[model samples]
Target chain A: MNNYERYMGMVKGEQVDYVPRIPILMHYAAKHIGASYADFAGDYNTLVKANIALAEDFGVSQLDIMSDPWRETADYGAEIEYLETTCPQCLKHPLEDSKDLSLLTRPEVGKTTRLTAAIKAIEAYKAYGYKEYSITGWVEGPAAEASDIRGVSNFMIDLIDDEEFACELMDLCVDVAIEFAKAQIAAGADTIGVGDAIASQMSADMYERLVFPREKRLVDGIHEAGGLVRLHICGNTNHILPVAASLGVDIIDCDWMVDVVKVRELFPKNTVIAGNLDPVEGIMESTPEKIHQNFIDLYHKVGNPYFVNAGCEVPMDTPKENLQALCKPIQYNSSI
Target chain B: MMDLKDLTEAIKTGNRTQATSLTQEALDADLTPQSILDAMVVGMDEIGDKFKRNEVFVPEMLIAARAMNESMAILEPSLVKSGYKPLATAVIGTVQGDLHDIGKNLVSMMWKGSALNVIDLGTNVTPDKFVAAIKEHDAKLVGLSALLTTTMPSMKATVEAIKSEELSDVKILIGGAPVTQSFADQIGADGYSPDAASAVDSAHQLLGIR
Candidate 1:
């Protein structure tokens, strides 16, 4: 089977010819076309070109539509400073000095700056991509969006000193994420990747009380929009794996600290799982032979429903050969 | 209304009122500065244990930490004036290009309450800033933190930079949600802890303070 066919088969819970390769290539894309991160995140054409080039060069089964963490907050009027080598970050949160929820306006997905461009790019990709391949879009989860709006430290405090406000903020973020997910679906995305790296920091109680409901709401909304949901929490979610699995995510992207064997146990049989490789140790700093074995081991741990990816974004300077090693086994081994 | 044993239990269960009231009562009863500190450490230690076991979480830990810090404010000066010394001096900070400091700050607070002299370098610390702080404070150990995979390199780079400067003897400790012992060894960090409580254990072992 072709790469796209294999990926679709696995997602559909059918037997696949091989494990799907879906690297989280962001800066890798910019480097592919020799464009800077600043240009890649800020310009729609550059992003589309970079993502397309990466999918072709790497033979990845799915093409992702993700930028830096600042996209949603930027639409709400936060000041963002872009960089060449690093993902763009919020210079200052829009609500840094205030808790006036009334001042926060719900951003219209397709009309927001840069967001519209993302939708346009996804729509553009569907026109060009072959039928077998799937396009994945992206949105910031509520906890991450809270960090973008109120700053990380402040939000941690808000969780305690102001529970009501925290819930309000999360409610607003969920609404915005639902709207954003819908736009990406309308723009031709077959799946939506929810980036909620910050949510993993909270205690299970706080997470259940404050974060999980909103995430479930957002995930439900994306499903309603006719797109599959991939949840990327981006940390050692070992303690919360059961909670994450219970959310009914199509794929739970594990960070390196979470053991794949443990994740496989937490979720039901046939739940799709991806990642847990140390990006620095296994890819950026290790040899190709070592990296390939790591992938082989990961596949054995999680079996057929797994997608090949790092715990998070592929490092900017990861040796080309090291990353290329990730797909070597899948390309050669029929049942990987 | 506040009993010492109950305070320790309260902190473990994230009971702030009992923790605070007992802390004040401990002071009012003429309990030795050292004794109150001992009780606070006991409470924090249990909280840390629960954290490792996944019984308590960040928000509960935060409340327990805040209660400990507030009590420490009243107790720290007394301990100092009584010629008490922190078990060791340690410095902590989050690496460059990463602004997530909730984990780092929590670790630092736990260390401070556990009787270590902690110098916080705040977020987005460059190697130069770290090196300068190490030299200025004469800190024996360094703690590096990062929440982003993209910023993990900065932790590795800081370790290399510090070693390259011939300050290799300075024991470096690393932690955060994304960091693991394998990553710590690969980066040449002297120690790694998954949570704030373990950081105290790491600090003690690295310094031979225990």
Candidate 2:
């Protein structure tokens, strides 16, 4: 079966040929295609090409359109600098100095700066994808986009100093995310990965109070658009796993520090749990054999309804052999 | 109830307005800056320990740090006039090829709260710049941060570049999400810390400071 079918099959609890490898590959993909990270992030054509090339070479199942958090932030009139080798840098957060909500309006998906570029990526993937891969579109989750425009430190303080203003800002952000997620779905995305990485930094109570409802809104919005949801939060999320699971997204990614055994028990069997491997140690600095064995052991422990992923992105300079070892498929283990 | 303990509690709870006012009140009431600073440090110390135990998360630490900073704005001038010096001068930054700075910034704030006299070089800092800052400040410690695993090599490169300089008495402290103690040893970092509060302890341990 094709990778897309294999991915959905596992989520649907159908026995697939193997667990699909849906590791997030952006910087690594750019380097793989000999394109600068600027080329990969700024231009959708380049992003699509790099993802395709990465899948061809490394056998990652998902064709991901996530380059950076600045896609929507840039469209909101933030001055962003695209480095040759790394993601774009927002020179100034639009609301960093003034907590001005008036400075940002909803960006039209096709007319705005970088959001347009992402839509073009979804369209481009649809054009050439041939239903062979699971095309994953992305949006910064409510808190993440809020922090992106307000600066992380400022936003964190806002959460404490003014919960009301924080909710207002996140309300606007979640609206934007919902709109963006729908557009990507309309443009032919099978799944939308909502990256609420900033939420992981807050206390579980703060997250449940401020972020979970908005994140739930975004997830429901995506599902309403006939798309799947992958909630991607970076850093240790052992505190918020139950709240995260309650969102009922199609998938939840556990970083290396998250409790994998708890996650396996927390997520329903059909909700594909991806990751819990240290990207730096398990993949980057590891031998191919060790990497393979670790994944195999992880797969067995986490059981079925899993996607093979590192805790986060595959480091750009990971040994090709290590990636190959990770991608090397194991036969479907139905009984696990 | 106008005690320094209130200042400590204000800082710990991240009540910036209260922290600043209490700090000023302490100053007005003839509480020496050092005693005030010590009380404030206890609040940070408690928060840091809670952070390490996962009883508190980043927001608590952040607000606590912000509160400490707000109070420091009032307290710093007095400390200087009283002939105060920091524990040591330290240089810190997110390594080159990585621009994510929450971890680095938190560590910087923690270091500053501990009276380290930190010279923050900001994000995407190159190894040569680190070396230059170390030399310029005659810093006793260097803390390198990178959020992405991709930039861990940059950490290694910075460590190597600094080691090659043979700065006789400088220690390198490395951290971020993906960094491990083994990675620290492999990269030749003098020390490693997983969170911001412990970073102060690590810095003190590395430098043999109280």
List candidate 2 stretches off by more than 4 Å.
none
Task: For model 2, report DockQ.
Answer: 0.74
TM-score of each model, paired residue for residue: 0.89, 0.97
DockQ of each: 0.46, 0.74
lDDT tens readout by residue for model 2, A1-336: 988889889889899999899887778888888999888888888888988888888788888899988989988778889999887899998888988799785677868978888888888888877478898999999899989989998888888888888899999888888898898989989999999888888888988988999999889989999999998999888899888888989988889999888998887768888996888888888899998888889999999888999999888898889889889886779999
Estimate, for each residue in B97-140, the C-alpha lDDT of model 2 and write its tens digit. 88888889888988887889999999999999999999999999
TM-score for chain B of each model, two decimals: 0.94, 0.97
What is candidate 2's CAPRI-style docking category based on DockQ? medium
User: Quick one: best lDDT, which candidate?
Assistant: 2
In terms of docking quality, model 1 is acceptable
Q: What is the lDDT of residue A175 in candidate 2?
A: 87
Q: Which numbered prediction scores highest in DockQ against the true structure?
A: 2
Give the candidate number with the greatest TM-score. 2
- Pull out the clashing pairs in model 2: none
What is the per-residue lDDT of model 1 for residues A1-336, given as tens digits with 9 covering 90 to 100?
A: 876677777878787667787888887788889998899899878888888887777777777778788888888888899987767877889899899977765677556786787788888788878455778889999988988899886787788879899889989999888988898988888889999887777776677767888899998999999988999988777766667777778888988878888888888766778886888777788899988888887787677688888877778778889878876646324353
